[model samples]
Target: TWSTDGVINEYCEPCEAIVEGELVEVPPLEEREEFSLDGVTYEAFNTSGGLGTLAETLKGKVRTLNYRTIRYPGHAAIMKALLNDLGLRHRRDVLKDIFESALPATLQ
Candidate 1:
């Protein structure tokens, strides 16, 4: 039987077509602060699960929402070193297909 009735998750809200708007990304920190590194910098990149439409709807109501691009802590550094320093996003589609073909999916 085909049905759209049992699709949306517990936290999901039917927003004004999540397709129409650009993804909403909010940094994890509620308060914005400045930081010092090699060059003067401020804390901005934060991580949160932007699983589909989660962040887009929570705008303003919640101080912060999960960022889509940035990773948390070591994740950002590691991924940057791999994806940027080494470069991987370019061939991601091929890698994804290979990985999917090699590893079998398990249903819980």
Candidate 2:
């Protein structure tokens, strides 16, 4: 679900196990890659999203799978700075305020 404050809260059925982690610097190859889909160019980078859960469920079933998040160029770096360098991850309220104020919602 999404909040008016520009925060997206997600919920899912409890997994048998949950993966906990911290953000880490992505390798160059995984940091930025360009791809074309449906005549539109996009940038992608490795992110610690739901891959851990998927990996746990697919253990031994698939040889390998790579997961990435598509985002605007430089978006990862900015997020890293906000959530890691600036230590906003520990203060979600501040982060939400920043998002709500600095970034106006857009249909596009």
Candidates in order have lDDT scores of 0.38, 0.53
In model 1, the Cα lDDT at residue 50 comes to 36
Per-model TM-score versus the true fold: 0.35, 0.55
Tens digits of lDDT, candidate 2, 1-108: 335332321111111222233222233214468888898787875544335666666555665544566766676677768766888767777877887888767674
- In model 2, what are the clashing residue pairs, if there are any? none
- Residue 2, model 1: lDDT of 16
What lDDT score goes with residue 37 in model 2?
A: 86
Q: Name the lDDT value of residue 101 in candidate 1.
A: 69
Best by lDDT: 2
